[model samples]
Target: MRKNTFNIFSFDTTIRNPQRNIDFLQIIDKIDGKVLNEKSLLIYWYEAIGKGIYRPQNINAEIRNKLLKGESLSESEIKRIMQDNPQKVQNGFEGRAITHFKALHSQLLLIYDSQSKVVRISKLGRELLNHPYDVQNIYTKILLGIHFGSPIRKENNRARVFLNTIFVIDLLKREWGKLEKESKGILRHECVFVLGIKDCDYTKCVSEILTYREMYGLKENREYIENYCVSNDLKHLKYDTIKTYVDEVFRKFAMSGLIIARHNYYDFSSFESKKIEAILQHYKDYTFMEFSDIYEYIDFAYNITLPWIENNEVRKQIATQKAKELHISLQDLDFNDLTLLENKLNQTFYQQALKSKIEVSQIDTLLNELRILASGAQEKSSLDNIPEPLRLEYLLALILGKKYGSKNLESNLIYNENGEPLSYAPAGKADLLYENFSFEATMIKNRNQQLNSETTSVARHFYESKKQNTLEQRAMLIAPYIHWDVALFFKFCAKEFDSKLAPISISSFITLIEKSATFSEFSTNFDRLFVDKLLRDKTDAYVDSVNFVR
Candidate 1:
């Protein structure tokens, strides 16, 4: 019998900041075989965070004495801690279940050998580590793929609940059997107070949400939800925690372009709705796997169910949903073939690629998104309350990938479960690497900060990228507003080193649409004119590096 009988949905509260999760993954990935016990992980994590960074006077007497007396304290170690200034609060993090186990809760890492209690990063976790500059696609997939009983959650073994939650949300809002859903979308309040927490069955959850909708109406705020949470005492999460669950965990979930969370109501983005559609056939494959041993649990929970990992129950739901949509009998389609569902998804995505629009409207959308970020507006078409720096980094990756097909470039941003970019990179890598060229982007709008922080960082990235591939090497920096002096500083660096290190402003990036008829056309033209030209003449690389976009 499952200890956690009721399906209580939870995205780890600690995963609120995805960059922190990425940092945790990196520390672990560096370990031998990327494996370790939770106890060892805590000590390693504590040291890596430099948790005792406070000066000897500022530190508590006992802890400081223990360290100073037994260990030879070096001035360099203290200086390093002060210089790093780890700002993430570590109040009781040391004892909080390897609190950063947010990575495991997120499915980024997994308990590879459950018997030995060996924790290791997952395949997806390694991908995230490999690509720390951008994660929109990967993270978004993870968010949508998360289920009520996903083994990826904080407590996988004890829980026995089942639901393809994203599928459920889509079903609740999307038209079905030619009939509109009661709410037409999941309310923010519904997400916080109900959904996976109240019930594992999507149908039952829908009824529950509909009941709430009738009482609270279409628009309900956090206070209203908090009130209901206090009254019900469902699963006993604090009222404050309810707010964090909505604002942080769920906000990250919606950052995926697939989910439009504007107006405080979550629905499928009309354009990206096909993403849900593509996966619709696998909804029933989401189920809780019952395992007797470590190997069995890993095998079944991770693969056997995916009928999609341990992948079989969600396909049943998708088949039913498909039947309703087609207005056909359930007997009409072959729901039993798991391969059919996977193929259906693959077909939808292949169609998605062929459906790419080069129309002016495509650029119009990208440009508009950029403007919203630069103005620092709270309101937008879809994403909100997400970190602006991560958003900027994501947007730049998208823009560059658009200009030069993804096959040509790789980004270095890390993602959360929602597949949204959260951090730029680890210590020494550039934000983007494309055909021997490096591109770095920052959200720092202040000119002074750029001069202090970015000048040396940008130079370092350029040199690192160059060392990897010496051919036709160059680097580009992007920001909302590039300082003239900073641009000139790069120009001086260009003369001293490689001359192609340059910066471009967001304002200039906005004009990208006007300059190019289409993304492919822009890629072709740039490749032929600019990128190809440098290869012909070594002296051409000696030109000034400053783009002067202030």
Candidate 2:
């Protein structure tokens, strides 16, 4: 029987750029074992090809029978049969047979002539036929060639860079796993749909490839395929046909386990979670450390693990059960206490032994070194300079101190017996401290420098002083000009400080001090008055009235 041939020119327009054709093969390779059994197709084609050169009239019948019988024909027997049946050769074309032949031919499994006279299996087809079960490595090589190989030409002198197939596959698998279910469905459907119709015509092939390319964020490849179609004058494929093809491919992939398909959705399920997590780790901004720095350790222990835990009733309950473990009171557990705990946990035995041996003989030298360190260290309050709008804080502090017989305060750096500096301890409560009243000063100048020294000083004092034995009776923020934005910021900080720090304008503070007869009365009505003033129509106008530069 004469081999059937279609007009190669009709489909030449479909794959105008050879690169797009290669890209299609790569898509196939990605789904080889999972979506389609390339080996089954290879075996069927191999046996059919060995049974003599097939024409459209005899190709399908010959292959179907052999497949059903589970039979294989040797090369010599096929040649002998062909020689005996010379009269059976007839010239004609069959559409279904031609479609099947063209599909395999496009994939480079077979070669055919336009005259419908000759059809032969390719070398790759023969290799796949012979080693069908163990052809993964060979299949991978073929796929990589399709993905990276370019036709050689004299005019093109540019270099071509190719990503490693294994690397590309690994990256794609991980990225595929990360995609949401809907995205995975879209990608799977589009890829399969395009490849199914790729051999139909040049325009249909380009449309499918372009559709899939757009979905994958491959703009450069999409543009190349689109330009190729336009330059080649290929007729566009109908939208309905493309949609039908996509649905069909989606169904096939669903059955193959490349993706988990539901009623209307799909998700990638082929990758290992451990491998995917490993890949994801490379993209994270922070890493988990087993032994953190001293500051971070303190933050984790205090803020994260045991915040508000010190000097609490909970310690008494702990003392009843595990009193031996409770070496010190919770109130006395400062940085030095925590450092010693960490050292006991993390320091190796040899390191502790060496340290002890050196410390016994060099105690005086250590004391002198610590004294030098303490003399070199000095703690500066954030409110020291008092920048513009913040300079208003100094005025507020001065006014409060003068009117209430309070004092302007600073933080004092505490030192150990050896004279090494410990934590910075505040000298008194906030910027101004009266008998039981604490007043903080804040100034807002620029948006970036919203919270200056005075603001932080007040916040710190309010947080710490409220925890004292006498307990702070009241705390207030004194700002000359509080922009609406700055006020909102204070509102946020208020939550962090347990709402102890009431932000009030300097003008409001002065008015309250002048009107209230006693400190108790001032504290009782301060919040209500501050809220009334903050919410008044004149608040924005008040911000505008202030001489910010001065």
Candidate 3:
């Protein structure tokens, strides 16, 4: 007897036979029968929702139609028809079943994917007329709660029922396909209520959920295929290949309402509700994995899903709704956790660089880092001269690298109009000019002079030639350092380059030599400079000490 049956409905029962000759009256008698009514609808709902047994479809349709038609029942028509059970309230059995699964009944009637087509009773429901109670019904409340994607209501309520449905279905299906004992092979999809690609035939209805980018509408089932690709790590698969795969499974089985709402992809939102659902479903198995582990997984999957959902207006609305409930605002949040001021500064600096505008935020971040380095000096009491100069040089080096987009020390240049070379300069020559004189290289070169020569000169010379040919004259005539002597070196370099029509900055130095790439390149050179100066001063101090002893 190769008879097929639903998971909870079986035909091998005494009450419902193929002949339909059984005494319907006697059957109702044993159950303390009562006339069917809205309450009975609850009982049938319990059987279908709680036990996975399909309720009689015709009966529901009859009730709805009657209610709509406003047909009133006679006193006799409303009473139990069972001759022996006129006294019974449709039998205690009927009442108990309804009461026991009240939670399941409430949820499905309320929010069962209002979009799905109306369903009717299957032949299997008829077969279960007198079947024994099934235990799978126990998990219904839990699965329903999960499926509904709602918060858990107080004990054994509608929300609980929805979650229970999701839980059981997920466990029974084991990730909607082949079950893996290790559980690691299961594809983790980050979504809210997404349909599966396996349910749609892309070849025929490809534009089902076409998005903004895939505007061609070639074969995008909009929601399902994208989620499927994300869950299954099939991102590398070609478009047609994925479309073909989606067509095979989900073509007819559309009862599953797996669509979920999320913020603009993963990176744009803080916490996804679907992540919480996943944890609830798989928490026991993931206990040992750190919280960060799950967080990372959710984040990675979410970012990948961004391109598909970012432009979705409805998805954004839903994401916003969920975020509000969780007390998070997606608009002003970022992954870096930067303060408003800090963020503004960082962004301003980047914009300034892009648009060729000089800025000082680079100056601030560098100064902050320097303050940190200075505060951490190993010998605070000793207060060595090398430390402060080294910090200053290093700080200037970073500023130059950030401002000029080059970090190499050798790229910094200096020259005169007469083709004479000058001496070494700081890496952040541009920043120095902007800060010291509140103007760029051109303005400063036009008005400022070295050693009170208050008027600009047109001496044409390169740093190399000036230092080699007229080093003494150029050094004496070079621009003055406003705050530090090290900064003056860069100013002199810029002024000299402009005089010779070279106009090269430290950035040019980097382009010239790729290896000595950033102001940090000058770290070694500065260190040498620092040590030489320190030794010279120390020698003078030693001689003074010797003279005092004599």
Predicted structure with the largest lDDT when compared to the true one: 1
For model 3, residues 1-550, the per-residue Cα lDDT tens digits are 1122101101112212111211221122222333344455433433222211221223345433332222332333233222223322335434433332222222221111112311222112222233211111211221222321122111111122222223333442343234233221112121111222221122211122223213432222446644544553332345454433323212111111121212122111122334334334443231111113322322222232221133344344434544454455567444342334222332232232322211323545654544443232233322121223223333444455455453222212221111111111323232222111111221111122221232122122233334454422211121111112222343444444532211212222222223334334533332233223323344344223221222
Q: Determine which window of 10 residues in candidate 3 has minimal summed lDDT.
A: 1-10
lDDT of 2 by residue, 8-62 (tens): 0112222222222222232223223331133433333343333222312223456
Ranked by lDDT, the better of candidates 1 and 2 is: 1
CA lDDT of every candidate: 0.51, 0.36, 0.27
Estimate the overall C-alpha local distance difference test score of candidate 2: 0.36
Q: Encode model 1's per-residue lDDT on 1-550: one tens digit a residue.
A: 2344333355666545554455556556655253455446444544443322122334445434434222333445444443344434554333343455543545444444434545567655666677754354556545544544443443422322223456557666653323543544666667753443533455665665666666666666556665555564445566666655666655555544456565666666554444466555554554544445433444433332222223346446544554454355666667667667544533333223322321112545666777776544344544433455556666665665565455555556543223344455455767666666676777665556567777888898777666666575666666765565666667666667745655556655555435666655544444443333333434223222212223
lDDT of 2 at 33: 30
What RMSD does each model have against the real structure? 11.5, 33.8, 33.9
Ranked by lDDT, top first? 1, 2, 3
Q: Score candidate 1 by TM-score against the native.
A: 0.51
State which candidate, 2 or 3, has the greater TM-score: 2
> What TM-score does prediction 2 earn?
0.23
List candidate 3 stretches off by more than 4 Å.
1-71, 79-141, 144-329, 332-550
